[model samples]
Target: MNKVKVLVCGDVEGKFQTLFSRVENINKGHGVFDLLLCVGNFFGDTDEGLEPYRNGKLTVPIPTYILGPCSAVQVALYPHISGCELCPNLTYLGKRGLFTSSSGLKLAYVSGIEAESDTLSHHTFTDKDIESVKNACLRGQTNFRGVDILITSSWPKDIMLGDKGCSVQIEPNGSWLLSWLAAQVKPHYHFSGQEGVYFERAPYRNHSFSGSTPEHATRFIALAKVGNTLKHKWLYAFSLAPIDQMSTTHLYQETTDQTDCPYTGKMLHPSLSMKQVRPSQFFYDMDSLTDEGNQRKKARKDNKQQHKRQPPKFDQESCWFCLASATVEKHLVISVGSESYLALAKGGMVPDHVLILPVGHHQSLSTLPDAVEEEIEKYPLRTSALKKYFKKQHKVPVFFERNYKTSHLQIQTVPIPHNMAGRLKRVFQENAEQDGLQLDELPHHTKLSQVAPPRTPYFYVELPSGDKLYHRVANNFPLQFGREVLASEELLDMADRADWRDCKATKEKETELAKAFRCAFEPFDFTL
Candidate 1:
């Protein structure tokens, strides 16, 4: 009742002999697993190996749970798409539904790849299958806690949200319906296959959710195909307590490296049934699209065509960073460029704390074209010249960017005492360690694009020596973490000044400070 041991494998693909032999050895050495769950394409290009199991010539050792057929040859092996005990200790999980074990382990699954058109074969699932699964999961705000495991034959779209250096593009091979289901169900562990590769992302926290506190972090694992030539990992093993029998702490234990949940957009409304939320629905609202563009995209996005993303241009009329914006404070401007600018931060923790930001509505550099991204990268390297500028004043600049729940990119620069320069990184590390946060220093010469790519959430910092530290942010990360660390006793000893609001200055004071900074920086200003 405390917990159940489980074994999971990627596409069995008619390699039953090879897969089970390993399972038998694992049981002998690592203790017996209660059940074996198989995903991806269960049959190989042919089913000659499976004929023995169908005719009782072979027996499955571990109690096995599997899905519907994925190919024409495998279709003859299943009795139907519904549940069935195909052979000794072998069970079919059926096409789609919630499956609960006697040990209280709950599993949800969707069989087969996504359909390309209105035509769906036995190896494909449709919008109706998704609706049926959603309704059967006991969606009573409380009873629908979450499943222990979720299985899918095809990997979900956008599963790469937390990984660095890439974004998952919607392609013919991926399943967006599965992605939507993952967001709604919030399973503890999501297992998928069929792409024939092995990838395991760091544990990620699901949204705080609909009228619920933050759920447990989810672990996603994509296993390789059985007996593949490339020698990828095809098997995974773990133990977990059933939700009903576990205490909150054990169920929700936070991992050191946590990432943003892949699905961050709004979900289908409760009032709208799956009938109302069509599978054809792709990207949600984009405010800038014209009526004609919206209509065309709404119809063809389901086709999975790759269209160039057009992030709305910066609006000087409403952008607070733009000089013409309604909220712009003219007195704080320090330097300007064609594509970037610098300004003194309001309510500064230190009098000279400043901000480096884009001149317009850019959200992430990773999303920009390569030419634009490269151009932006070159601009910051020039600021390294400021080292000599700050050296004259007996101080060094520490820059950090936290892109959590923010649109416009803002890099905050704080100048610490010159003697404290060497202690900067160590102090930040110690602060994070005190709070059980991880501060990973990047390898030497790691490019900015490799730091935090498009659609990923992160906290990044740059030391005076140009070393970079990164934290893959999780749910509820402290809003003023960098500020708090810098304000610690080892550094500034201004712990009480961590919150910027308490350290604000009046308009006249801010204006005077900006003028002074302008005078001091004008001689070495790169833009000037």
Candidate 2:
């Protein structure tokens, strides 16, 4: 059970020493780890002086391997500096195809020559993008120990002109590069060039190493002796979507400051905003008493009166998913079906949202069949996926969901959470396992459905009852519900009182549930 750790490096040489120190410190007696995986960028352009380190010839004690594309051709074509091609370590790593050596250590490569083309100068590289790729690779290694060898593609740096048209250049080196480099050289070691600067500038810049200092270099070396990996562990991927698309795993914002934008405010698609509406009021239609507005206005007034009369906005029937106070947002019936309904409601449509509901008066998931349960589970995740899908497939982000009329179950819909990739990847991996396949070696073109066909609806129901019912109805009632064809009344009845319904309601009651259905709901517990 080798506790395999990966060292992710970028174009830095000095950091490798620090990386070794850190690895030695943490892994002192932990013989569980047998291999050190270097994701790439062990030495930078200036470090051609270390050319002798390549080809299983490095002075480092551990058996080492470096895998990467032989950029000799690219390096010759784009030589920003002299002797970069001769860097023994880079040449050695470039030829190994990013795999393990006969002796067992892993070596990988990043196309530094191509990277040189991407950046302003050979001496400077985007440390952040390099780190991002490295971190992701390291995480991939963490999942499986036998994956002692891993390789990552080169990270391209962007050199764009600012608004003022000044030749502003962004560069990262010293500690930032060193830390990242050291991490790659040795899996453990604290490397930070500009701790505050790295974080503060991260949002605005695409590269990581733009802020490194000599002071940080000294700290990097000292930390290396003590084995200190930087505090700001890099995440391989980040969810650009706001709160709804974000999974619980994301960095949570503590303040409700406007700077947090989508992270904290009401759920909205990334593109749409409240500012688009002129002189927008929070509850405009609800205040008007006209024919159309009267119903909405009366609804709001009734909710207000109820708030004044009752202990809280909703004792039992606030939408648990969206956390919408039915008393607040003016409701819009986006779609209505005999068995399910969609509503667009918001407290203050700072960002409008979508809501989905399995109609016909059901409150619990237990009433759903496995298929329905499955679909319900996919709802929020799919919502998140659709956001990414829309961005990828449609070039736009859309919000979707149906409304559950004044019910305890609030199924508010927004974009999916960001962490869904991990879950979906897991599902795909599991399916591959059943088929005796490996996820890592799987081709990118391999379709997900090919791996895990939508889980077949769990059970058959003579009547619309059980968790399977929701799946059946949600899938457009392709199955028979009762003795005859599917009936809306039967589905509603199933929704209200099925084995799964009790389970779902109980789950909802326990946890202050999120709108996304994919999330687990805690069962309500009484303390008194």
Candidate 3:
């Protein structure tokens, strides 16, 4: 089977003695693991806290990988050193890189946290550091098949969303970029520390880059700080096989009917089915309410009624793109400009596909103010800038816009590989003909408002080579014709991710995409 057992530990917090004892006990009881992966905060909480590790007072029992830039002093003293072997068995994993153990276990890591400023710190990792790692993966140096395990300093943001029995507020401490990277990398297992709570999420599947096939479910685990008496577990262990061993036969054959938590080995349904306690019942004693408390409650009720009587601030309550509405996922927003902003498209047709939209609620380009129209016209430049940033040397930008008359204005930018541009028009035409709808080629300067009457819904696809339009007076036309065409060109099944609402991503994924776009678009942002 060629399986490798791995022991994952949370923040050591300088509890070397306790950590050593725990590993020893685990080894004695459960047999030896191939590797020990420590997440972060390996040293104590203060400067000069790594003396024990540096002075050889503590020993790592197994081949241990510790996430690094150990301390400011160590980093400054050894700037050129990627990682140092603290002892025979202990080695730092460096700031951000990939490493493959002798057992053939490939691991990718992003060490440290996002700092508030540029000031260097032992535990600081920035978006650029993440981008470097991403670029390496894209370059195929890290093995595009995907890493066996991914380690990060903090828990991914919004990982708890849609998870039953979870009510904790996810703080912004975790990196959104890492979350997005996880989705792209599709690692089989992901480990994180620094959330102060031990959590293991249900495994979820992501599309593999190799083809349209879905990869095995990726398990995400967040460990609480070591030695935390309550709500914390010091370590976790799991068995993983080599990449080649992860074949369809083995995966399907080994699958069992049991629905147990992958980490805790408990029944998932039972845990998820636990009833939630009401806030009123859990926090208060109704019998103890005094007359003063009663009066306070009545006063609060009156205030709520008074506020409810006031009208809403914005009229576009139903518009998903409107920032004021709850439907707008703030994490998807890339860059905010004076008149318009950029955002990643949910269930995007291609990777890094983005949307440029005006700040105000406008049904169509014709209704946009002069200032907004001028800003919107600069989208072609922005699209070109994105192509350069992504290093799509042989790809050209394709812009698609829809003025469904009743829908808010948005300009979609997708990078189409040069080879696909020639056949893209034919592909769309054939697909439209299949749907019994005729496709019409339009001039680059042609606007939907001029072709169709006001409040008439229309879709347009614009490329540097030419432009195509589909005027729809009837509601039977496919609203997602552009996405469908692109998906078909890429040989992907559009039925899976055609609707954005059906394929909603976690906040972490959205944040990472937005951050990457924001950085790439920063140099080209005219508003800045």
Candidate 4:
């Protein structure tokens, strides 16, 4: 097997002489060390400290990869000579780029610390830096197949506290953005500096990739600053065979056993670990349930003998789709109508699936006033405009309104191929029949507007052809039944994509989707 012996070190802080001596002795003893990896702060604390290496008075003995431009001088000089040899056997990895050594081991790095200043500094990584890494991954330049090694300056956020018994005194010195990117890249080994300990985490598998075969587990190591007061060993070493040379059997044998994390003391599963670090926000509107809301809750609890319960008044603060909530993702809003708006479905069943919702919170479409119903029906006309855009024969819009509980009323629109129109309705009808509920078709305006008492709970499906509507009224209906049918394991076989969590992508992909939909739906926007 092709194997490379690597010597990894923490922030050098201009300890090149000491670092060189250590590498020399270790190479002499082992006779297998091929490369020296420095995790940054390569130059000392002062300008005078870099003089020896700048003047060639000191030299790097082995092929060295420095994850920096940590010093002002190095930073100024990097723009011209990045990716070029800085000195004998020393190569400067650019600010943010991928590198492959002569031995064929691929590594990618992002240099600099997370800083508070707006101006770009020598040791600062910015939002643009994060975007570049994401774009590279999306463009396939970095290839989703895991890098052999990943080098970054600051330790990943929560790394220390994430494992069991790990010290929290270190503070959360790592970047949340970097932690997120690392999850996407799924590097085999992640090396970082700026932390105060020589900590090596047990490997954890990443399931970010979509295929059946699992990606390799990642081993993370954080190095202490070199020449610190305690004189912690500034260097760390590990051996890894070239990915191409490692057989399936050999790779499986090398995998880390899933066990409790040494730092957080939690079970070390990648999905669970990623959840702890994911940057996405999910909001449940507790503030909306004020004293009045509480009284309603108590009243409902007290009125157990009542056959029909009155629904609580709509609170804009608690609605996920309301324009008033700061948590609403404005980017996902394709267009706004006077009363209703079109927005991309989060964790959509397909790329073209969307949600049409009222600007204000309503318990269900059936309870909406007559004027509101007329305006909301136009949502189908807007969705139909996307037929040519999505290259589908027509769009199918489905709405589920449960009056039993408080919820923001919204209609779901999904593009379907012409051929699947019959099967789509049949599947839903069959599923409803299995649950002993009869299907009924209701006209958009008359169904609820003319009812003696408003229908509290109902589901409406407007098929692709647009002539027929499938309606069902029930005391209970499966939640998100529309999405489940479109992403059904038996029909679409995409049940896994039913949940947004399971189909999460990098921020870049989300932005791209939003931008595309916004442009496609612009002409049909009622608010315009």
Local accuracy by lDDT, each model:
0.70, 0.28, 0.62, 0.61
RMSD of each candidate relative to the true structure: 22.5, 23.5, 15.1, 12.7
Model 3 regions lying over 4 Å from their true place: 46-58, 69-81, 115-122, 141-143, 165-172, 208-211, 251-528
Q: Which regions of candidate 1 deviate over 4 angstroms?
A: 55-57, 71-74, 139-141, 165-172, 266-528
* Residues 182-224 of candidate 1: C-alpha lDDT, one tens digit per residue: 7767788999888788888788787664556768888888888
Summing lDDT over every window of 10 consecutive residues in candidate 1, give the lowest-scoring window. 280-289
Model 4, range 154-221, lDDT digits (tens) per residue? 87765554355454355646676677667666677889887667777767655434547755667888
State in Å the error of residue 296, model 3.
Answer: 55
Residue 173 C-alpha lDDT in model 2: 27
Q: Which pairs of residues have clashing backbones in candidate 3?
A: none
> What is the per-residue lDDT of model 3 for residues 261-316, given as tens digits with 9 covering 90 to 100?
22221111111221111111000011111123445567668778884332122344
- Candidate 2, residues 1-528, lDDT tens digits: the string is 122343433323335555554555545654423334343344434444343444444445343333232234233332333222333223233321223344344433333322233223322333333332233223323222112222332221221112133222444322223223333323212222221122111111111122341111101111111122444332111112211223333423322211211011121111112111111112211111111334555676878777432211323133332223344332344433344444443331112233445543333333444454444444333233323333342222122111111222334332222333223333323433322233343243332233322322221211101111111112211111110111111112111111111122222322222233112111110110
Q: Between 2 and 4, whose lDDT is larger?
A: 4
TM-score of each: 0.50, 0.22, 0.45, 0.47
